[model samples]
Target: MTYWNQEIETMDPVRLRGLQSERLVKLVHYVYEKSPFYKKLFDEKGIKPEDIKSIGDIQKLPFTYKKDLRDTYPTGMFCVKNTDLVRIHASSGTTGKPIVVGYTQNDITNWAESLARGFTSVGLGKDDILQISYGYGLFTGGLGAHYGSERIGATTIPISSGNTERQLSLMEDLNVTAVLCTPSYFSYLIEVAEKEGRSLKNNKSLRVGIFGAEPWSESLRHRIEERSGIKAYDVFGTSELSGPLFTECPEQNGMHVWADMFIVEILNPETLEPVKDGETGELVVTTLLKEALPLIRYRVGDLASIENTVCACGRTHPRLMRLTGRSDDMTIVRGINVFPGQVESVLMKIPEVSPHFLMMIERNGELDDMTVQVELNDLASDKVEDYNRLISRISHDLRTVLTLSVDVELVNPGTIPRSEGKAKRVIDKRKF
Candidate 1:
């Protein structure tokens, strides 16, 4: 029941909405006056800053997307002058120009504060030691978690990703109590630890793992916790929303979205209308506190739902349910929508298979075909008939989940590439 900012975290619902409304008003005005992007967008939509006096008017404001940021590369959307910015972070730009995000002093503070709240919710405090296993530099996961860990007065390790030996070594020697990294990397760490004749399950110091930066499943969470002997909590946020913002409280249910900092909306992807609470939809967020690069009604592209009822831990903020996957990460095969997370969930439940998997999609003639490459754990039988039966079982289970039959390929252990960061789950060979 411990909280970083108990007052803000446990604020009354009506008062929380009022606070959000107040911030939304100021944010609208600030962006309208300072950012050319917002000004032009508002003008083009025939919407004025005054029109958005409350959070309910958020629907009137036009939606923003990652494409908007990409279309206006390198600070075209920035609200402040270069001198006001203290730091900059950008994506890999794998598809186009990297999204350049600037941070003012206040922006950095708020970013750390957001994550600090999350870290504390997971039982991390001043007395804990935190090992940051995320990659440093352009990626936000590293430095973002670093400042947050320090903000909580936790002894912080800036040992960026890669070098499995060193990560495990420092983790053990330093008695690291918490770890921040992509869930896939942690799974690899667990595998490597097992191969090295060491068990993370035996580590007395490590108790909590906060994993995100990619979509995972509740099944994976259960598997990870069972194997590593630590409470695995899902952390939620994107590079666009200031990175590693919210995490599941020790209740281990859903991530609590700070109401005063941001206004979150879960909308139906097709209709662009708010979904009923507890129903899955696209996550749209408006950052009320971002100074250098505030986004309004920005389509975060992740598919999830919100639980507005106060959590068992007594926090009043909305909880972001498990994300199925990003909108872009989804693929349509035979007119059925498929997400990597759905595939992961199905694979993780199979006791004979490892958590590592890759989904391959191809087109033959007029039809689309999907083949899932699953890695076999040591428990799987080596007999050809047993392997065939295992594949049949997996295919049946996948069909039950995805509603589509898929060719299942069971590969030997270590056959799939291990990721030190986000795990690649899809290989679509179909054009258009």
Candidate 2:
């Protein structure tokens, strides 16, 4: 139970590259023959499947973007027909048309295997009770974790999200050992528990927390660990990449990407060239095992760094560092780049403020104004002078770190919205 598919997980670098190269060679021909979208792209670029001889030649292929998935819409990008698909999941489509993904029986099995490796790495097994707090239905987080929990033979509580009273009741009644959900939701749970005169630190059953679906910082991790008294691990992936695919090992250094199933490349966002090892850049991936929707050189829009050096846990697959921010999520306020992660890092350091926050950006008389609305911790004083002092302190700290002035508005606890899914951190009001 210590290692799932140990042979491939611990494969040598040389042989792993050979396997990737072979898979890439076959994948190029397969996509060219089966997918009309890729065939048209290849013909327009004057490239054939024979051009891709090794993994090094992957650079010759065109990159796929989120827009590409949207342009294809429902089933244009799928290599297999509807009869072959066992399941379908999609993005929220808040911005535009939703990006749909298909999964065959093999795809489902592989995805579950990926997640099972993650669950086992975090010490989850048949004896554990897992509460899946992520939302279900079209979103991938809920069902993905459920499948993995079942795969590991754990007693899963399939509790989607919401119902704070019931969530807490089940945790104590069922003696839930592990939970899967976004970090924000977990933080809210801690707040609710305190209001009810209950402390998670005193809970004997909960041991591990698998948090993802949004970018979080190390400071937040420490806060969760301190509040919940559990080892918190970050799980990472996108709907396009088959939901949650990578998880940190027991060492908790970084998330290990399965080399046999994926080829990851960190590239400069503007130049599209590979960045040096351990340097942050855009994350691009090529799927080797996907049968229904095999994406080649997909630009996943996440900013992160990767280390190929062997981990202390003895896994040879490369580890992706905690994501800094998404390239698309960065905002330009008053001609200075501002990332929500930068804001979170600053907020997490202030003990008077809670981790929950919202960034409001609006245009005022041809200039953009940014206001940060943050909630005060329960212990914070409600005196008028105290509020003013806290606001000034936060504004000064943010200006120092972000190198730009921003207005800070302090509010009572629970003023900001609590999210059961990915927290909506930004609200831009500019028309253009």
Candidate 3:
């Protein structure tokens, strides 16, 4: 019932690299001529478009960062004609200006097909009614998942996001077979279902879940599966690239990247050179067959490692390790590096605490201090002793794991801000 060629998905590694190189050369030449941003970059480096002959030559191209896209603003990096663009999406520029990404009619089709391939890779097909909870408009999650459902001949209820009551209503009434959203949102949904005395296990239609847009640990995945009555798969991508660039198969080893569309590499962030297999580094992607916004060696700040081998499920497309975190999102406290995912892993272990939380970093007397503000479950709010104990436990955990102490504040329900899209977990009050 799926549209993708199984043979292509499991193509031999040798042939896959050859196909990628051939496509990359064409993509580079096309973008160099059509995109002003790429043209300027190549010219500045004294590199000719024809100089890019193979996938290996991709390293010779200057890397495009998020800042470059921001500088280009709305439509400066668009490679195709304006009339060819059928859709547009933008990342929530909470930190600065939003980076815009445009999709041509073909680009849209390619994205939908690729997403459909991802869905099928994780065992979704025509029988499922997918409930898409990812927000629509400016964000790419909704439309990207919607198209995949339609392509697979499944009924897609484009419910978008929020309106939790309505979302649950549809899940129950419509017998929704699958759900898609960020891991955090899914966690929050489980809590809501439990509070209302609804049993997720009793819901027969619920089966598989595709979650991403935020880094999540295996503990979180197990938590979601235990509470939501579904097999959780990590869906990885960004607004810059069409969403669903990589996805985990049923085996859940690592997400398989579409080598035909994307040439992926793990690079040393400091050296900007390729890292050895099994080594963590920044993820760099070069779009192979893109017509619009063809990015060559674009440095997506996410940290991960390359996995090339036959999976237990028999897929041959190179696998990408679950995104560890982002280079830009790392926090240094007392000379110790900390990631929010690490903090979340610790917080989830506490039974009384709610999933909604925030990390506040500020400078105090020329030294940095972090305060983890977390909301507790409603039933445990009145127990002051329990609250103090929870805070003490968290502080001790942080001190042991991160080698740094932090103030842990237990807040009331609804005190922490809810995110409709990507959650804002960190607030750095220090003026830099």
Winning model by lDDT: 1
lDDT of 1 by residue, 119-201 (tens): 88888999999999998998889999999999999999999999999999999999999999999999999999988988899
Better of 1 and 3 by TM-score: 1
Q: Candidate 3, residues 211-262: lDDT per residue as tens digits?
A: 9888887767876787777999998988888865577888887888888888
Clashes of each: 0, 0, 0
Q: Please give each candidate's TM-score.
A: 0.98, 0.97, 0.94
Would you give me the overall lDDT of model 1? 0.91
The global C-alpha lDDT for each of the candidates, from Candidate 1 onward, is: 0.91, 0.91, 0.83
- In model 3, the clashing pairs are none
Better of 2 and 3 by lDDT: 2
- CA displacement after TM-score superposition, residue 280 of candidate 1 (Å): 1.1
lDDT of 1 at 52: 83
lDDT for model 2 comes to 0.91
- Candidate 2 — worst ten consecutive residues by lDDT sum? 90-99
Q: Pick the candidate with the highest TM-score.
A: 1
lDDT of 2 at 180: 93
